[model samples]
Target: MTTPPDWSKEEKAVQAVQMAFDLSNDIQRAFRVSAALQDMSTSDMVRKVLQLPYQKNRARPRLTITLKDEDFELLAEKYGLDPLDRATIRHRVSEDLRAFAGNYLTES
Candidate 1:
């Protein structure tokens, strides 16, 4: 059977760095892993070391919230729907709002 894409040495190095460890150790482990696993690129090797969810996963944009869990819960309860279920509903609402706003948002 044909093979899947392999991780490169550099990829491995990066992955090791991302792990919860010292920077020097991560770099060393990365090289060792790349050689042991026969990774194609350091990039790919890093992906393997980290056991990341996807091969081509790009960074997600982050949204920061200053609210504490208790405070957030109180706010969420006031709005309706348990905080636990808000994530899914919020995504749908966000998409709908974006589509409705569309070019009008940019024009103004």
Candidate 2:
């Protein structure tokens, strides 16, 4: 099978240690939504908000979000894509972020 054109292979490093916060639901949702609208992952968003140095030239430059089976089902239905096609679902989500940012700019 041919690799999808949108997918790129990258050399990955050992996983970095992750830090998670236990924010109130409202706060977490607000933070996550704000980042999504800006086409940033929460990690990058937090780094920017805290005035930390931006890490450049990442091995893989991509946004990530944890999704449950229900989310995949919902998003697949929303995008009219097959539920089993995770790669396509991911591409659709990235497209959605761009669309959200575009709409947000006109509204602002």
Candidate 3:
């Protein structure tokens, strides 16, 4: 607004109306924000808005118990487990295989 008031009266009126509209929007936002703060502190709103990170629970180690065909079939019957041969087991449950070998293997 440092520029001279050289414009005609209509432009001045339009500028005043736009400033009024901006002020109204700011006032309305302030009221809504004030009401929310009255119900709960601003810190509470921030904490709720910014979610805390999720923490993972510690899980027990997995073990592989190889079952004989009949026993495996019995396990399959009892727990509804699909039969898995050693090679298939090695491929499917690769994570447990190393731990199982580590626990039972003789060092070469």
Candidate 4:
């Protein structure tokens, strides 16, 4: 098991800063695909590529993704929920993810 970076430590303080870089769409897709194949997050993959120490299990253990208004509308239609209800949509998405992981584990 790997340990997450300690923000309280001065040497690991830099890890507190969030950073982003512009990359080509193809590169982004490829990187995501590779990470998924290895069952790792893209952040962990980037850390691995840079030879930086990273934890497999993060302190927060939560997944996040940016979604647009259009995405919410689409998801609402797919799930037969009200588009304006963001909280319910979020809860439904979480439930779907949990169900997916359960199904995947049983199949494997």
Q: Between 1 and 3, whose lDDT is larger?
A: 1
The alpha-carbon lDDT assigned to residue 50 of candidate 1 equals 70
Each candidate's TM vs. the true structure?
Answer: 0.28, 0.43, 0.18, 0.51
Deviation in Å, model 1, residue 49 alpha carbon:
33
Candidate with more favorable, higher TM-score: 3 or 4 = 4
What lDDT score belongs to each candidate, Candidate 1 first?
A: 0.58, 0.77, 0.51, 0.85
How many clashes does the backbone of model 1 have?
18
Compute the lDDT of residue 71 as modeled in candidate 1: 57
Better structure of 2 and 4 per TM-score: 4
Residue-level lDDT of model 4, residues 48-72, one tens digit each, is: 8889997665555568899999999
Best by lDDT: 4
Instruction: For residues 1-108, write the lDDT of model 2, one tens digit per residue.
Output: 977664233322334456888889998888788777776766777887889865433446565689999999999999998999999999889888988879757563
Candidate 3 regions exceeding 4 Å error are 1-62, 81-108
Candidates arranged by TM-score, highest first: 4, 2, 1, 3
How far out, in Å, is residue 63 in model 2?
2.5
- Which candidate number has the best TM-score? 4
Per-residue lDDT over 42-74 for candidate 1, one digit per residue giving the tens place of the 0 to 100 score = 454555667854344334433334656675477
Query: Per-prediction count of colliding residue pairs?
Result: 18, 0, 0, 0
Task: Give lDDT for model 2.
Answer: 0.77
- In Å, residue 16's CA in model 2 sits off its true spot by 10
lDDT, candidate 4, at 15: 62
Q: Worst lDDT window (10 residues) for model 3?
A: 52-61
Better of 1 and 4 by lDDT: 4
Structure candidate 2, residue pairs in collision? none
